[model samples]
Target: MTTTPPPTAGAIDCDIHPSVPSIEALLPYMADHWRDTIVQRGVHDLETIAYPKNAPLTARPDWRPAKGLPAADVATVQAQALDPFATSIAICNCLYGVQLLMSEDIAAAFANAVNQWMAAEFLDRDPRLRASIVIPTQNTEMAVAEIERWADDKRFVSVLMLVMDENPLGRRLYWPIYAAAARHGLPICVHAGSAYKHPVTSVGWPSYYTEDYAAQSPAFHNMVSSFICEGVFAKYPDLTVVLAESGFTWLPAHLWRLTKFWRGLRAEIPWVDRTPTEIARDHFRLTLQPVDAPPTAADFERLMEHMGSDEMLLFSTDYPHHQFDGNAVLPEGLSPALARKIMVDNPKNTYPRLQ
Candidate 1:
């Protein structure tokens, strides 16, 4: 049999999702009690869950069937990996974290199952495949346990969390997870999804998928702001956080407003020692994809200029998510060097395991 070559030396896809039937795929690897719960309750559809008592409003659901798995063979991924322009692919699984609202115990079990399965089935299968470890934020102890359990595995690159809940990212409850990531030298990546329990907007359910798509950035902004105001970056100086799925354009304006407010009301958040922009610029990285309509080179340039560091903005196709357009959304006239950095170098640097 002919062997498939590894991805080119310069390419790395920071965001990719390996589809799974449901949480059941990992049942055999789960503990007896957890496996029983999975078999009994079956998988909960995250979009249908209610918000935790004190959590934020639920995000609107413009439902679509889960993009479970692709029909393409391993050779297809190998082709993309080996494409001279592509280097490695880091796959982020969805349902894993979105299932958190189901029940704390089940959520954690689901997370453990998914991580172990991904580690065994995907990452173990391909040296080029890197994955995010999902945890159930609803139960911090279980979440921390799973983080500690897998932090040493090089195949696991980051801890994935959803942007929901009113609690600040810097809360003491989350510190253990941060410590685990710091111990492993892995970044924590936050993605938007059902936030099923926490909706930041008051639009009374968007009418269409496009509206929901548009709302993701604002919700992300709110979550990011909560993290900053709560001094998450300040509290966990060594930990890196990546805000994925939300585009980068709003960042500059939000930072400006936040810093201005902070300058006037420093007393409110005395723990925040550095300006919001500095904290964001230094500790946070963001993924770029689903670039807003009328894509223009100038817009991309402006966003890059505002972010102040090309390295902080990573490329993500949000592959198999339908909204993604491979390579085409990149603005015309973007230099190969910049393209290379956005597509691969930045992600590799942020998630060093990819290297």
Candidate 2:
């Protein structure tokens, strides 16, 4: 947040979205069967719970393309996000509808088509761009297969997921997907969202999108807890995990509570030898957009101190989704060194391919 620090030159934007133009654009990447299935059934694009196409928060007014959906093309993305921010490298995380289906096979097919489309349309066009390998969380087998398909591409730096999934992320059933990702040195990027398979709350669904958005903090807590207690980091010590668009202001208290409880509950999970905070601090990284810090810079600094690790944050504009006014994006109160870490060093460490 040091405003006078060096400009974001040679910096990495860890999360910027490029909206999928249309279902038709993905047809070329789809398998023949799915292509026929879609046409035959007259299936429309599945709207994602995370970002509705027309939602106010989905696209900043100025960033919207004149002729098409916001960020639906490479040129618009470059002009709006990359060029203006002086970003040297921008990682595109497309939040498409490939994961909303009940049928794992169809979901897998669409996920495949989406990744293929991303490679062909985005990554292939921009040398400065990298992308997350979107997977069908419904089927771990297909998910792992998708990972193997793009694992060798240094441009596909991480595996993306919604914060809430069909099951607890720490379950052993999901470990195969994690194993494959770790094998390829891909961090799991859990964005703030859900498939809406279940109600967002423990009791039931929420009344509105505002509730859903604010509830993300708790969801992230449970998600991180599941990963820690389930021994994901313990199992894959070298792996990194990124919480994209995840407002991390709540992390300090969550981790502190978990660690305090962990001491008494040590016997339940012997494999989790270290405290939850230590493990999470070592393996987890978060995006900096929508930082949700205190109003004053001093209070924000106090929260940063509470987080205990400088490496936990990686910079992101959350482009096309306005979290700040034009150009004055960096949060205030960070020391020159921490600002550099968030903008450059932390991301490079989180994503090995970035180096």
Q: State which candidate has the highest TM-score.
A: 2
Per-residue lDDT tens digits of candidate 2, residues 174-201? 8988999888889999988888888877
Question: What local lDDT score does residue 287 receive in model 2, on the 0 to 100 scale?
Answer: 95
lDDT of 1 by residue, 1-355 (tens): 9655432245566666555544556677789987776568775533323222112222111112233334122344454423423555655544444444557776777777777777777677677777788888877788788888887788788888866543556667787778778778888887765554544455567655556556777877776777788877777777788887777778888899989999999899998888988888887888766455336777666666776877786776555354433335455545678777887778778886666
Error of 2 at 260 (Å): 1.1
lDDT of 2 at 204: 87
* Cα error of candidate 1 at position 83, Å: 5.4
The reply for model 2, stretches above 4 Å from the true place, is 1-6
The local lDDT score (0 to 100) that residue 25 gets in candidate 1 is: 66
Off by over 4 Å in 1: 1-9, 42-85
Supply candidate 2's per-residue lDDT for 52: 64
